[model samples]
Target: MGHAPVMTWTVRRAGPGDVGELARINCESWQHSARGVVPDVLLDRMLPESYLNGWRRWVRLPDPDGVFVAEDEAGRLGSYCTVAEARDDDDIHADLRTGELIGVHADPLHMGTGAGRAVHDAALDHLAEQGFRYAVLWVLKDDWTTRSFYAHHGWRHDGATKDHAAGDQRVPVVRYGRFLNARKRNRPPSGFRFPAFG
Candidate 1:
């Protein structure tokens, strides 16, 4: 087999103007990357135009939550990453120091070209900068390719599982976690809370 093509890209915080392209990329990546993992019924509903408004709203959200995109030298965006503080008050740790890797999706044409990695790394850096001590992500249990990708990057399955809603279906997903910045653990002062990202 031919070697996987090498790809070069730079990551940056997403802006209002990027919503359209980011929406397109999100829908396209889901259609391609989640093909066999997510139920066909759900994947079939992923349409670029339908995602534009959602992308617009998401990109406008404040810090602690972030959206980033990877662009090649030619100015074409190849992937995007979204992150925030972990939302689950049950199951996953939902504290000031815990964050979530909401998603990292790449254009099908850039799947093996390193675009995903660039944005993924940048998302983690953003979380660390926000003072997150740990990060978690959820992936379809059957998406071996994606699970392996996270594993290669030092994430470990954290023995948590949930039935995530995918359209009308509930599909099993596993959680993976990694330490963004390992340090002695200390409790936040009573009544202390990080500013809400929502």
Candidate 2:
């Protein structure tokens, strides 16, 4: 009359070992979902090995306070996120809102399993804990699925645009944002935490 236990996943700082899995998720998710949104050339360039190397370099970047990964019961990474306060410092996006949800990527197979949402929640929770009052990110105007994905999570339309690079192609992107309460932000996980804001 015994039952099997439930398998719980944990979200924590990403380590060097997660690079391979993270790259695979990044490559597969982008390649499969962003077909018409991103340029074909860019997809071609996101080669598996290239992505692995890229992640290796990324994990070494001077990000003493960014990047996180989610691991399931098997201790395998399922998704990851990169949160930054100074978006301008990075060339990935144009606007570079002071408080921004820099980047979030999830495994294609884990799309609807809440891994993406968990990654995003962790980022925002971290930022809000860091005292950020607002956050922004650019989404392709023509990428309805991606847009809906953001909207479904409560991002308000900002009615803005920015030049996005899809390989060599430049396209205008729509902006969306969310205003953190600044008074009651989500709490970060224990040990590693950011100062609370009001």
Candidate 3:
């Protein structure tokens, strides 16, 4: 019996032409993942066109390093991630040179297909390449799946918390951070294994 061909993914910087699909992916991924976390009304009100316009404007700005997308050999976009300098309100414990993983999303159908990991690794590499010593990200406090994913990838929560206003509700979030160079040394605490790409 013949084995199925192994699927591979490639990560690349997003361009102007990708804004429409990126907006669709962002909207769909958010609706799937944040259905209960974010207000249903807000999620329902999200328009892909609005996100497309926003992405278009963002990509046109002076950011040479901004967003990235992961695609399979079949040219399907499976995941995307965005990185930026840490914001003052991010409550990060790292130095001012830290970078932030502002957003990451995987198409629900591609959740376990390694696309997410590829985007994440690419984002970290981009941050390190840009001379950021540390990286930080925020997750909903009750998002165990996301928290576990970050922890398994060598990130640690540093007791920082923030509440983001969503409509009339406040959603609590926690911060996770990791040293970019330390990851290169494969020194993740508790023997966490960084999976190698095929």
Residue-level lDDT of model 2, residues 1-198, one tens digit each, is 343333355888776788888788888877877888778778767866667877787776653246788778788776788777655543222322246665677776666666767777877777767766567777778878778878777775666677887767897788776655432332223453233222
Off by over 4 Å in 2: 1-8, 60-65, 89-97, 182-198
Model 1, CA-based lDDT: 0.81
Q: Using lDDT as the measure, name the better of candidate 1 and candidate 3.
A: 1
Which segments of model 3 are wrong by more than 4 Å?
1-6, 62-64, 89-96, 184-198
Residues 62-107 of candidate 3: C-alpha lDDT, one tens digit per residue: 5425788999888888889988877764444323357888878888
User: What's the TM for model 1?
Assistant: 0.87
Per-residue accuracy of model 1 over 1-198 as CA lDDT, tens digit each: 565697889899999889888988888888887788788888888788888888888998898999999999998999999999888865345444788998889888888889888888899988889988778899989888889978877787877798989888888999887767532232234575522322
What TM-score, over all chains together, does every model reach?
Answer: 0.87, 0.76, 0.84
lDDT of the candidates, in the order given: 0.81, 0.68, 0.77
For model 3 the local lDDT of residue 101 reads 88
RMSD of each: 5.5, 7.8, 6.4
Q: Is candidate 1 or candidate 2 better by TM-score?
A: 1
